[model samples]
Target: MRGIRSLNHLPKRCYAAARRSEALTVPLAGIKPSSATPLPPQNVQVSKLPNGLVVASLENYSPTASVGVFVRAGSRHETVENQGVSHVLRLAANLTSKGASAFKLCRGMEALGGSLSVTSSRETMVYTADCLRDNLGTLLEHLVNVTAAQEFRPWEVSDLTPRVKIDKALAQQCPQIGVIEKLHEAAYKNALSNSLYCPDYMVDHVSSDMLQSFVKDNFTTGRMALVGLGVDHSVLRQVAEGLLSERSGAGAPVAKALYRGGELRVQNNEALVHALIASEGGVTGSAEANAFTVLQRVLGAGPHVKRGSNITSKLSQGIAKATAQPFDATAFNASYSDSGLFGVYTISQADSAGEVIKAAIAQVSGVAEGTVSEADITRAKNQVKADYLMSLESSETLLEEIGAQVLATAAYQLPDSVLQAIDAVTQDDVVKAAKKFVDGKKTMASSGHLTNTPFVDEV
Candidate 1:
């Protein structure tokens, strides 16, 4: 009887399975695909508040959003009395603010699945916050507190000394960083000569009063730009008008960066030599700067392929012929608001450093003498355009780009415009840029086994 019952149920099960398979192959009778229209893309909208704060935002409609407070209080703004204050202030971002305690600030950001970070360069300090779009309001409040409402308690500021030392120690581990810092120190007469790290004497000595005074002098509305991505422009404007308008006026006069060529060398027993030789190039956002940028790509800014030799680089080709040792060479171009540095950076075995450095500079000389072809210029322009476009694809980089431009020019140049500017660089313009670097006063910074490295004047 049990076998008979099982046999009877088997036919019904088979029928049900057949029906399910049929259902899997076909759509249901009444289901329909979505008919809603997609939203139109929004361009970056920029406006200024009555208090002189620049507000810029783009509605990318992304799930994640980012906002940054860009202030002109970089190392360049530091005075002789406040050297390394910016470095200490960068580490003090998470300290208790006027509106929130340090503990609450940390926990609030964590609860919202967000992050806040502070990064400074020679000319700017950016306080950036990232969070989901739904929780952007809460995260943005934290950013405001960090940038505008800081208390900088003495004990908390004192606690940042160890971190500052760690930063300097870690930077010491990288020869590239040391060389760059030395380059800046050697390149400028006054404003631009400041190092990004805290000096040894000022590491624990950057007092709370100093931080507060620095903020009071530099974090004014006129010197700040509030920028955001994947956000509503009006909301950003409201935040700027409401909370960020406290420091209304231009707080202090800015001193222009003066470029004076010199040299700084560090003698060490390391097996490798890192050398940078530069000349005054072009101011930021100028046509000359664009040419310098194109020239950088022509000489090869860096390897396009990861861990691959830049065989196509003129610097690499030139240096490879001069020495058989393993070496890396690339063009280095840094443009600031008032000045720029254009040069070649080379790293080679200590014994081959002189040959590598001379060869790298000789490549620039070749370009200055019209050795570069129209084809080279075209390829470099393409590279510049591609790099600029690719950088904007990331939300974080895009925010930074927008902030930098707005802070500098009080306006944004569209990508098409930027590409057009890059394309407008003629072969003659590149040659002229090369000639400027070849003829201008040079600043050199090198580390590791100076016995083989050439001096600035020698190069």
Candidate 2:
């Protein structure tokens, strides 16, 4: 996490300009510029290959190089029969480099002191690597090979498939996981929320052939995006072209959108009380969506951990020794291509969890009711904006943001534009967004000692 904090030493001119204007009536706390305000990304070059792949490049003066492959395939693309296939696909992707006999992609990556990994979100799968700039030649060759020359061995798949399945099964045993499953099932009903990741049954059902078929249909050059940073464009392009030149996709079509609605509750035998609530929030493009984004940051972001705050700290401390735990809450605003979800989760003493949920509900309800003051809006805005700026410290983060933003939406804008949009969000906007969320259809799911919790019955 050695992130943008290092940028504190950058020339004082940049820092000085970021200082708040003295003449403004707005408190310095409200209007102080964050790192995101001053730095605009240098120009990004975008081009398309004849085969339909997109290549986007940005140069960072940072010494490390980062590369990523983003594909438009995730669990949303899974069918009931193939529910966990995407997860399997992500796992299988790693084994390709491990199996590469001819070029030994993994060995080459390691030689460059680099690491490669693949991760998935609700809509896309991302394969990424970071290395020293000098090793770009060998690293690119190996990177392309892993995606292009994937050779799934019978033994490897058999071993890996079971291991992942077992791990997922074990994870589900946790009360937190059960609560999440219940929440999604409640909020999204049978739709994409329920399908964020494949269930264990689907994982067990996935065969090696199904995985290969998924790869064939989804890992298309036509649907792929290549993102690179801190490396020469020509060298990266040459490497990408050489490996991908002859490769042609079977051209799988994009998946359909699914939005089933309902509520789910999992009653578990445990001492901890857990409750969750999720509701409809707008997506990235809507004005309401922007308002919701700022509101979430204002309400949830903290000087503590990513999900830490005085509320969580106080709740945990109060219930630390009680039969019911003090309340621990996590509020999330998840965005997707077509829709989004806003959620609040809590864990508290079996008896007090209900009160905790009430407090949280009351808190958000006030936001909905337009009770948040200018000071609340200002602090939340500043903290949210500051967090965004602090996150841009590394080339990898910037690289990931660019590639994911493109895959999520084909259009890309500077971080400054996003910051400006956030800055422009007014108190009225956040309250309006909150009202929409509370009044709209939402879902709730939970597990572990929640049978008697009030949120379970809230509606």
Candidate 3:
């Protein structure tokens, strides 16, 4: 007890002063927020290298920076034989690159206290590293090496087997995921229907050769973008020039996704029934899509504020009040390169699944058939814009958004422009976008206890 040290000599004011000093220490002191000055519409600088590689970067004041390379090689490019190639490639990211052992690469990242992760979507794959500004150059170099590295060792491929199996098992066990997977399948027959996850049957089929081939074919400069957040734009450009190749395949053509509305019902003993009924929504970043975005908010996702049973959307409220048993209905809108889906997902007990789905259908039909009020449209537009702006607060998400926008549209959408687009969406536009899916063959997917789940045509 005599040896025990305490800060008795330090005054309490010292702690307050330390915190105040910390708060005042800004990374970039010149950068300050001012309402009267009006911030720049788009501060992100985008440049294309001689090799046709697009480099997009956001300059800001932050201790941590997120940098990544987003490629167009995803499930859309996968063939029947290589259905899970993207998932395999995603796992292969940051593994042993040429001239760098896995240990060395991992050690290097660990030295900088960085985190590396890979995510694969329906039409893109993103490899991201979050680290300090001092580590940016090293991290960017690693991203390039990771992208172009050829060695997808058989041992690593074998290790992913259990992981792939676990992914499939987890999806099967979670009816929410199962219903969404099936909904995509039912919505689009061929191209867009490719599962984001590696399927159970295809787990054994994804090999190192297939992944390497995918990289060779799709990891091209034209099909990819190097993106950075909270990093100097000029620094990003230099890294892009030094690392990414000016040569590679332009990637396989994206298969046109034509919506074919149908029904998919999978029976599992999971007590809770999960069902999704959606119609084709809007294209990526399109006005119609933006309208649907507003409509989704207007339709309501769930309770706006937590704790209370009072839901904001008519459908949610209807489900809450109408169902004898407890249930939840959420509005969903999934977007891709060319096509989109707008629907409501409902989860309910087995005995009440049918009624819940029907109630959801009635709500959707009401939105499509009935005229929406000006106040609802105005509120939904504001909500959609707020959601988009809030998401931009994260460096990692901003990096992905920048890269994805570049890969998908070859242009950036400024936040102001997006707000203007939302502002332009009138009630008529909302109604039309809502009815677009309803007019088309409805996409119905049901999982879990199917006995109580409504059939496709029944609703």
TM-score of candidate 3 on Cα atoms, chains taken together: 0.88
lDDT tens digits, residue span 1-459, model 1: 644666655666677677854655465679875679999988989998778899999998899999999999999999999999999999999999999999999999999999999999999999999999999889888998998899989999999988999999999999999999999999998888999999998888999999999999999999999999999998998899988888888888879888899999999899999999999989999999999999999999888889888989999999988786557999999999999999999999988898999999999999999999999999999999988999998888999999999999889999999999998999999999999999999999999988988888888
Compare the candidates by TM-score and give the number of the best one.
1
Better candidate by lDDT, 1 or 2: 1
lDDT of each: 0.92, 0.68, 0.80
- The best-first sequence of candidates by lDDT reads 1, 3, 2
Clashes of 1: 0
* TM-score for each model: 0.93, 0.81, 0.88
Better of 2 and 3 by TM-score: 3
TM-score, predicted candidate 2 vs. hidden true structure: 0.81
lDDT of 3 by residue, 105-127 (tens): 89988998998898888888888
How much lDDT does candidate 2 score? 0.68
Residue 198's lDDT within candidate 3 is 88
lDDT of 2 by residue, 1-459 (tens): 666666757898786678666654345665766546554556766666777777787876557888898887777666666777777777776575443653356567778999888888667888888888887776776777677667676666766766676657776767676666555555553335545555756655677777767777777777777888876667656655667654566466654344454666666677877777767777756777778877776556332656544453222333343335435665667776777777676776665666676666666776788877888777777776777787777666777778877655554678798788878999989988888767777667666676567643464
Off by over 4 Å in 2: 1-42, 97-99, 173-178, 189-191, 194-198, 239-242, 245-251, 302-309, 312-326, 455-459
